[model samples]
Target: MSGLIGKKIGMTSLYNADGQALACTVIEAGPCVVTHVKTQDTDGYQAVQLGYGEKKEKRTTKPLLGHFKKAGTTPKRKLVEFKTFERELSLGETLQAADVFVEGDFIDVVGTVKGRGFQGVVKRHGFGGVGGQTHGQHNRARHPGSIGACSFPSRVFKGIRMAGRMGGNRVKVQNLRVLKVLSEQNLIVVSGSVPGAKNSFLILDK
Candidate 1:
């Protein structure tokens, strides 16, 4: 399965046919335009390049301007390619949210996660530091207890979980159910939380 490019508009609750409130993620899927087609003979791969979201002509560079003009489309803010597309689509073709998905379908959503800068061992690595403040534990509340054995390796092994930057990376949430498809509003209501904050680019796949 495949999906058009979209922006996550956030999440909300909706009542199903059985009157149970279900949580759903609202994304503004496209009427994405096919900008270019990659063929096996030329590119050694098969894929379709899609353009989504609009930007002012002045904001787009001249190179991009020529590219969009070749595709006969206005300057778009984002362009993404979808590989192994199931449908036979062509350049200048428009793909809407309704054409890609339906209720109860499982999809994988990929996006950049929200950034959390420079976290400590407890928050970043989930380490339970020394648990008592009463026993002369001066400032070892969130410190990593023991890095390594006394003189076994004489140094900490690589890849030991440590505090550092968190999030702000490409993340894929897989097997999320499509709860609703609001074609009228060009919205897709998925079953759970997706990566990134509001209005982030999301790629959906089956």
Candidate 2:
């Protein structure tokens, strides 16, 4: 289970050998520095903590600054721990996109979806609403009808799907085929759309 921190660089189309256009999401992956190597004896688990993206020293906390200093790396914006790395790595070592992924590799991407703030059932839960514009229905076409039962059970059931805040959730997109890897640019092109908006941080793992 090798993984890297990345940012969604946006979407683009690629032409295959057959001249068919393939939609793909471009990600700027890695160039991550290993900040810490946790061992079973020290931390009860084996994992590698990697740091990616630059951060201003003033914005970094004292504790984190010390941690980065110990690793001999500059401040980083994102830190993530990954278990089961492909190879043993030492602190301060760098991991690039090409080191972990290759074209035709299947990987999983985890990211936070774009936030939609407050949303309606029609948009959030795919509810069809009232379904008709007639039958004395005017502004109720998009309303969620009948949320509760008659006096007996009376209350809305727990875990009922209603409109509220949507998106901005951690989502995992699995089995995304790696279409291309630009090692020099630390970029990877993956098949299909991934979670989150452009420039959003993501975790790419295999």
Q: Best TM-score goes to which candidate?
A: 2
**Pairs of residues at least 3 apart in sequence or in different chains that clash in candidate 2:** none
- What would the per-residue lDDT of candidate 2 be over residues 92-169, giving only the tens digit for each residue? 999999999989999999999999999998999999998787887888978888888899787889989888999999
lDDT of each: 0.87, 0.95
Q: What is the lDDT of candidate 1?
A: 0.87
TM-scores across all candidates?
Answer: 0.92, 0.97
Query: Across residues 1-206, which tens digit of lDDT does each residue of candidate 1 receive?
Result: 45778999998988888999888899888979998888999999988898999999999999989988888899887888888677798778888888888888899999999999989899988899878787799899998888788778889999998889988999999999988898988888998799999999988886
